[model samples]
Target: MAKGYKQMLAEADALVVSVTAEEMAGKLEDDSIVLVDIRDPRELEREGMIPGARHAPRGMLEFWIDPESPYHKPWFAEDKIYVFYCASGWRSLLATRVAQEMGLDAQNLRGGFSGWKKDGHPTAVKEKRRT
Candidate 1:
């Protein structure tokens, strides 16, 4: 027998905190909360992201968070609470779980960026990065 994506997602969801768009919006002004967007660049180009959110592609997350890793990002060591979001929350859920296991204060947005936009939340576009 083999486990599937749904089972993995369920397990991650059980362990990760899921915050609603409204809750996240309330925390926007909190200096201790850092909203993280984990979608790929193409997705971001197709859809805007939460304002002031930091972009950390899903692929580089673990490396960026590990202090011992040469790719470690200083922000990962900050005292802020990280709230991750993807297009529809799936990737973010798994990301939250992994981040927590790596000793981060992390949570996933319940409905992700799509839900946030649907709920009329504020969005911002990132400047294109040179390749």
Candidate 2:
């Protein structure tokens, strides 16, 4: 029997959750959340992070998010409230949805990093090396 393309695509997108950065900020301020930055190292190396956000990287998100995986400890704690983010927020949205599917209380940062920048939040610039 042949598989349906739509069914495959839908399955591909089945696990992801989403939220806005503004909503995240409010939650963070109240000490109610944990920020997970799932962007690649190159992007973060170029643009820096949102101060206290943990680096998980999209490539290994599923692995790291899994309690059975060794990479889980650094990112997960008991009852952790994770909020993943990316450059444009789409990635984070997809990620959070996946987390939700995985039975985790996760959300995505709206507008991703850009939302934070637009809100007058601080961002660190990678200093050019003068060799």
Candidate 3:
């Protein structure tokens, strides 16, 4: 039998550390932390993201994190606490686990962007990138 989404989420959850929106909000001013939003472009356009969060779409995450990959993002090489979030917490939980395995100090945003909005945290509209 193949592992289902639930099994994957459970495995990821057990391995990754998750921080609540309130806790994350307190770290907004912390320079040592890096907020990473791992959602689709459409989702970001429809719903704004956390202020100061860097957009790293989920599909390209592995490539972006791998230093040897041509798609590697230099920021991912920085020595900072990376907090990954999606619209909901599920995607981020899995992403966090992969990041952690890749040797980054990564954590998941509990309840994700929805939770952050519900908690009244500040958000900023993402301008469409010119490719």
lDDT on C-alpha atoms for all candidate structures: 0.94, 0.73, 0.96
Per-residue lDDT of 16-109 in model 1, one digit per residue for the tens? 8899999999889899999999999888877878998999999999999999999999999998899999999999999999999999999999
**Runs in model 2 with CA error above 4 Å?**
1-18, 124-131
Ten contiguous residues with the weakest lDDT in model 1: 122-131
Cα deviation at 102, candidate 2, in Å, is: 1.5
What C-alpha lDDT, on a 0 to 100 scale, does residue 33 get in candidate 3?
A: 97
Q: Candidate 3, 30: how far from true, in Å? A: 0.6
TM-score of 1: 0.96
Model 3: ten consecutive residues of lowest lDDT: 122-131
My TM-score estimates for the predictions, one after another, are 0.96, 0.74, 0.96
RMSD versus native structure for model 2:
4.4
lDDT of 2 by residue, 10-119 (tens): 55345444566566666655455788888887788788778778778788888877888877755465477788888977777777877776777886677889888788
